[model samples]
Each structure stands twice: as structure tokens, then as C-alpha cells.
Target: MTLIVDQSTINIQVLFMVNKETKKALIEKGAEIIYLKGFNNTGINEILEAASVPKGSFYYYFKNKEDFGIQLIDHFLVRFLSGADRRLSVTKSSYIERLRVFFDDFLEFFKGNGFKGGCPIANFSLEMSDLNENIRKRLDTAFDQMNNKIALFLEGAVKNGELPEDLDTGLVSNFILNSWEGALLRIKLTRDVYPMKLFYNFVFQDLLNFN
Candidate 1:
């Protein structure tokens, strides 16, 4: 037997599809806004307006503002991690060289953006961690994952004899991540790229102890 779907059912499905698209667009727009202006300063209406989505649509997609914030954090983390992975996996560069490329790319990003803001993770960690447990946990996991990737690189460096075998890779990884975050904060505060350049130089010359 053949079955037919009603026009009303088709219309409802189409509406749902449209609503889902609208929601995705709004979430993406909200993520950009949050990255630039921050979580505390961003307003729901502002996000909706920026996205050009109506209030009904916004609420239909997200339970509340905080829910959207969480989604934004997840999206940002995925994108950031993917970029880092690509940079670290470059075929032509040595493990140590890839690490240096990572630092150079970060500093170049700051310079290219005119140092208006630095790392989104660092920004969100400072702003959202104090007020939201859920966001704090998400940020913490992302940080740990990032540090682990760096540790893996450091381990490769040690195997290649680029880094000393006796060094604690885990501690060195955390130290680099922590120091970079601090350096980004200083660069943002100073509105200058000097801090980033200095940090990059120090990481290569002193921290990594590259010969």
C-alpha cells in the first residue's frame, strides 16, 4: 500500500527545518559576539538582533541565554582545537619546529588582529569561570586537552633529543600553556604585540632550551 503525507505535516516539517537553520545561525552569530564582547557584556536581545532572528525563534532554539553561552563555548573549543591540530601536524616541520610555528602563528594572530583581543579560551576562563560551574568545567576540559597536545609535542621533542630527556614533559606543557595565556592577557592589556613577540622569543630561546 502507498502512503501519503498531509500538507499540514509537510508544512510543520518545513517550519521545523527553517527554525533549526535560524537557530544555528543565531548560535554562530552569538558565538562571534561573545568572543569579541564577552559573556557578561553580551545581551540576548543584542545577539538576536545581530542574528536578525525574532524572540520567539530564539527561545524556541535555546532554553535561556546561558544555554546559548554553553553552546558557543563548545563551538569555539572545537574550532580552536582543530586549528591547533592542523598546525602541529604540518609535515615539513620538526616537532620542535612545529611547536615554534604554533607560537609564531599565535603571535601573528595577535598582530593580524591588531591585538584587540587575544585567546578566546583565556578571555572566557577569566570571565565565565567565576560565575558558572558548567562553563568553568567545559573550559577546564578544553585547557587540559590543549595542554595534553602540547605535552605530546614535547614528548616527541624529547625523543628527538631536541629537549632534555630528564625534563618533566607534563609540567613543561602546563607551564607553556599557562605562560602563553598570561602573555596574551598582558598583550591585550597593553594594546601592543611586544609582549607576544617577547613571549615567543623567550619560549624558543630560554623555555624550550633549543640549541
Candidate 2:
């Protein structure tokens, strides 16, 4: 005999599923707004209005604004890391080519967005790190993770003779990440992509000198 499910129960389950998606959509939208405008500049009302989510629904998903900010950072990190992992894992590309692909993707994104907003980590670190210890620690961990991942890629390059055997992978990774951050800041200040392009060119040429 087949077991029959209650229609009312099914309706309740459907509503629950929809509510979960709605909550995720709200958080994603809220994160985007915060990334663009910054945490301090993005008021709760604006996020709620932008997400078309009521205050009650926001509270249902988040304990407070700080909690929401943490989740937002986590969400952004997942997306960013996933893309980086995909680019770095491509088998057909040389290690150096993979690195170039990574940087080129970032450059295209910056150019596409008109460099209106900079890296989300950099933006959040500047805005909330001073005021929030938890957020500061999270941002710090994210940066460390990014640096480590790049360093691992560099280590692979060295292993494959793509880079100098004696090259300091850790330092090189830090330099690249730090330089990119600085380039992004310059882009924001100058309202131009020339600085970013120059940065990429300098980095590419410098890496070629590794042999």
C-alpha cells in the first residue's frame, strides 16, 4: 500500500521551502548592497527595502546587523574562493597561465564595474575592522586564506620549473596580493583603470623575470 501525504502538510512544507529561498535571496541582496555602499553607509532600512524583505523577516534570519555582516562576509568568501579554485585547477593551462587567468578575470571585473567599488574584503576591513573584533578576525582569516592559496599555486609553479627554484613563494604571493589591493585602491582614488593595467603589466613582466 502507498502512503498518502497530507495536502496541508505539503503546503506547509512548500511555504517553508519558499521562505528559505527568500531568506537566502535577501541575504545575498543585502550582501551586495553592503559590498557596494559599505556597512556603515548601508542602512538596515535600505537593505530591507532593496531586498523587499520586511524587518521581521530580516530578524527571523539574523540575530542582529553584526550577525548579518558576518554571514555576508562568509557568503562572499565562498563565491570568491570557488571561482579562484576553478581557475587554478584548470589542467590545460600552465601554472603561470592559470595565474594570468586569475588576474585577468579580476581585471575584467574591475573594468566591468567601472572600478566604482573595490575589493569587498578591503572595503569591509577598512570600515569595520576598527570597530568590530569578530569582523576583523574574520577578514584577517579570509586574507590569510587567500594568501596561502596563491602561495600554494606559486609553489606548484616552482615545482614545475615555471618559476625559479629558489623563489620565495610566500613572499611572492604576499607581494602579488598586496600589490593588487593597492592597485584597486589607486583605481578607486583616480577613477581610472590605467593604474590597474600598469600594475598587471608590471606584475606580469616581473614574474617573467623569475627564470
Best by TM-score: 2
- Runs of candidate 2 with Cα error greater than 4 angstroms are 4-16
lDDT of 1 by residue, 54-167 (tens): 766677788877788778777877776776688777867777788878777777877888786778877889998999998889889989988988888899888888888898
- lDDT, candidate 2, 86-172, per-residue tens: 887897877877887887787788788877788888889999999999999999999888888778778878888888988899898
CA lDDT, every model vs. true structure: 0.83, 0.84
Alpha-carbon RMSD, each predicted model: 3.0, 2.1
Candidate 1 overall Cα lDDT vs. reference?
0.83
Error of 1 at 151 (Å): 1.8
